[model samples]
Structure formats: structure tokens, C-alpha cells
Target: MFGILVSAFNVVLGFVMRSVIAKFFAYFVMWFITTEFVSVLQSAGILPTASALAGAFGSIGSDVWYFMDLCSFSFGAPLVISAYATRFIIRRIPVIG
Candidate 1:
């Protein structure tokens, strides 16, 4: 029946959406952890990072914030799509009760 198929689709959609969110968050958290670890490693060595010229060699501080921001969006866009699709499906569903 159409209703039964819709029910299965709904369940699968929810599962897939949740899976995507879980994976993205897991990877994002790892990035945060790595950043902290690297920061500590840099500071522990008493190295000054103010000079941009020495950045490539890991002796100076380089701007990694921009790159992180760019990469974060690749994960965020899917979340946005999943959220919108969930909303649209819920709205389109008819209540039989």
C-alpha cells in the first residue's frame, strides 16, 4: 500500500539523516581536539609564531582559522539540507488520526 511505503521511507530518511549528523559531528569534534593538541605542542616549545614568514616551517604561527572555517561549511551544508528535507516531509504528511 502507499501508506506502508511512505512509512518505510520516513523511517529510512530519519535514520539516514541522523547518521549524517552523527558522522559530521564526530569529525568536527576531532578537528577541535587536534587544534587544541597542536596549540599546546607549539606553546610547549616556547616558539614565537608572530612571524608569518616562518609559518611554513612550523616555527611561526600560521593562519589556520580560515581553512578550518572553509572545511566546517562542507559539513554544515549537508546538515542544513537534512534539516530542510525533514521539515518539508513532516509538513507534507497527512494526519489520519
Candidate 2:
């Protein structure tokens, strides 16, 4: 009974650990690739920087800026981008998809 219990525990633990490690590795790779891709786009002037975004926001009327600030668009933009990126990456992974 004791041997069986230990074996079962080991199996469960191994499965959990494997899952955790796989997910961590996948997310890390996704993040690294996303970072590099964003860097290249920014360098190429295809993507605007934070300061440029802020400047554009400033140029807009105060009411519009206030609405944006209230809606927290600055925080939402990156979050939405990350969500889409994760979805894209996951779809590319056969095992997960």
C-alpha cells in the first residue's frame, strides 16, 4: 500500500511539474520574441513609442485626453496587445491548440 501511494504521488507531482515548466517556457519564449519584434518595429518607425503616444494625446483636446485617462487606455493598449499575441502564439502550438 505504501509503495503504491508513493508511486501515485510521484506520478501526480511529475505531471504537475511538467505542465508548469512547459507553460513557463512557452510564455518566456513568447515574451522574448514579442519584445524583439516590438523593438524592430519601433526602430523601423512603424510602431510609435510611449513618448510619441503621450505627445499625440497632449495635442488632442483636454476633454479627449481626460476621457482617455479616465478610461485607462494607456494600460489597456499593452494588455490587449499581449492578449492577442498570446492567442496567436497558442494557436501556433500544435499540442496546445
Candidate 3:
């Protein structure tokens, strides 16, 4: 009975560790790729800078500009892109999808 319990515990621990490591690796890869992609976009001038966004919002009105600043397009663009990228990647992975 003690041997059986020890075997079961080892099996469960191994499975948990594998799951945690795989998830951590996946998250790290996704983050690295997303940041690189976002940086490339920014360098290419496809994505505007925070100051540029603020400047554009300046003419709109204080209320609207304040709202824009609060929402923060510069920050949001990467977040939105990363979400789609993650979804696309997950769907492409046959085992995970």
C-alpha cells in the first residue's frame, strides 16, 4: 500500500511539473515573439508612438483626449496584436488547439 501511494504521488508530481514547464515555456515564447513583432512594427512606422497619439488627441478636446490617454492606444495596440497572435499560434498547434 505504501509503495502504491508513492508511485501515484510520483506520477502526479511528474505530470504537474511537465504541465507547468510547458506552459511557462509557451508563455515566454509568445511574449518574446509579440514584443519583437511590435518593435518591428514601430520601427517601420506602422504603429505610432505614445507622444504622437497624444498629440493627435490634443486637438480633439480635453474630454476625448483624456479618455484616449486613459485607454492608451500605444499600449493597447501591442496588447490587441499579442492576443490575436496568441490565438493564431494556439490554433496552428494541432495538439493544443
Candidate 4:
């Protein structure tokens, strides 16, 4: 009964997770595409706005900060996700008798 319960739980968890991931990625990709489109539009514009002017004000420190933030998130997010997924996969697989 315990084995059955554990197996059932893994199956249910995997199925629900897959469904949620599918939906989440669908919306996520759509959002990324739209944001990229908007960025392209902004770049194509001839005149700059307040945001553009303000963005130009910073010196080396802000540039370093920007790079650091980008690097931290770019590397951190995927590494954390992969590690967490590895743990999840390990947990989900049952040991052979």
C-alpha cells in the first residue's frame, strides 16, 4: 500500500507538473516575443524619450551594476532550475527491488 501510494503520488505530480509547465512556457514565450517586438520598435524610433535620456546619465558604476545583475540572473536562474529539477527527478524515481 505504501508503494502504491508513493507511485501514485509521483505519477500525479509528474502529470500535473508537465501540464503546468506546458501552459507556463506557452505564455512565457508569448510574453518574451511581445517584449522583444516592443524593444525593436523602441530602437527603430528616431527620437529618444525620457527613459532613453535617463538611461544615458550613468557612468561606469551603473554599467558594472547592470552587467552584474544581468550575469547573476542569467547564470543563477538556469543553474538553480537545473539543480532543483535534478533533485526532483531523483526523488521521483523509485529504487529497484
Candidate 5:
């Protein structure tokens, strides 16, 4: 499920890049950076541990897929909100445009 979301995001990013080479480059760099950042966070225990995340659903007798969806919403919702806010803020910046 998370894999699918990441793949879909890549496709959208590809369209934004507008060139085959640029698309590939962007995907690779984004993947590398995201992978590393997640790794570091996991290692630092900033992000939930896999076993802990699984246990969270198990305690409530829910499946991992549902938990993944919940996690997606938990993270994605704020990001979408922030993106909108950032866009508005950037447009209002007199020097940016």
C-alpha cells in the first residue's frame, strides 16, 4: 500500500519534471533522500518501530493495511495542509514572484 502511494507520487512527479531524463533523475534522488531520512528517523526512534506500529493495530484487532491507511492519513493530511499554506504564503511574498 505504501509502495503504491510512493509509485503514484513518482508518476505525478514525472509529469511535473516534463522530461524522461529529468524524471528518472528526480525519482532516483527523491527515493535516495527519502530512504535515508526514514532510515535515520527509524534509527533515532523518532518514527514508530515496525513492531510497535504492527502492535498498535494488533491491540485493536485490526489489520496492517488499515494501519497503513491510518498512517497515510495521519502524515499526508498535515502535508497537504502545509502545502496549501505554503503556496499561499509564497504567493504573498513580494520578492518571490
Candidate 6:
């Protein structure tokens, strides 16, 4: 699912970004990009199979807004949290001289 994909993306992004910039900025930028990407896909109706599945769940209403919100939050929350947490831990360990 998208949630799993987002989590994996975050893990990779965190690893890559840490070497390029400060932790906070890296985390913020990556999180912003990922969230924006998801939002854009939702708004633009570009999500894979979304249109096809729309009719199947018609009784629930159009577009499944709640489901999208849930997916985004479920996927994005852990990534955002881990981004900062991992950085914090790395920074905390005393370097062996």
C-alpha cells in the first residue's frame, strides 16, 4: 500500500539526506516533499487505480476523502517521527576518539 511505500521512502530519504544537510532541515524538507507529493496525487486524481476503485465504493461517497486522509497519516506519521528520532540518536552517541 501507499503507507508502506511512504515509510520505505522515508527511510531511504533519511539516510540520503543526513549526509547532505542538517538533520532538522533534511527531515523537514523530505517530509514536506513527500507530503506534498501525496497531496498532489490525491488532488490531481492521479493515484494508481483510484479512479477504477471509486465506483466500487460509491455508497460511501465520492473520492473516498477519509480513506485518503487515513492513508496519508498512517504512512507519513512514522516517517516524520523516525526522521528526527534517528538523527537525534546519532547525534547523541559520543564519538570514540
Query: What are the lDDT scores of the predictions, listed in order?
Result: 0.62, 0.77, 0.75, 0.65, 0.66, 0.63
Give the residue spans of candidate 6 off by over 4 A: 1-21, 48-54, 57-97
> Model 4, 1-97: lDDT tens per residue?
9999999999999988899888888778766665565466468884356676457645438667687687885578558856874465445434311
Residue 90, candidate 1: Cα error in Å is 42
- State the lDDT of candidate 5 residue by residue for 1-97, as single tens digits: 9999999999988777788778678668756665565566568986556587567656654475587687896688558856875565446444432
Off by more than 4 A, model 1: 46-97
Task: Name the 10 consecutive residues with the lowest summed lDDT in model 2.
Answer: 88-97
Tell me the alpha-carbon RMSD of every candidate: 18.2, 5.3, 6.1, 15.7, 17.1, 20.8
What is model 3's C-alpha RMSD?
6.1
Pairs clashing in candidate 4?
none
Candidate 1 on 36-77: residue-level lDDT in tens?
654665679643354642464354233664574668955775
Ranking by TM-score: 3, 2, 4, 1, 5, 6
Tell me the tens digit of each residue's lDDT in model 3 across 51-91.
98568656787687577678896588679867886686567
Between candidates 3 and 6, the TM-score winner: 3
Q: After superposition, how far is residue 24 of candidate 1 from its true place, in Å?
A: 1.0
Error of 1 at 50 (Å): 13
Clashes of 4: 0
TM-score of each: 0.38, 0.48, 0.49, 0.41, 0.35, 0.31
Question: Between the candidate structures 2 and 5, which one is better when assessed by TM-score?
Answer: 2
> In terms of lDDT, which candidate is stronger, 4 or 5?
5
**Clashing residue pairs, candidate 6?**
none
Best by lDDT: 2
lDDT of 5 at 50: 55
Q: Residues 5-81, candidate 2: write the lDDT tens digits.
A: 99999999999889988889988877777667666756998655779867766778878878988999889978997
Worst 10 residues of 1 by lDDT: 88-97
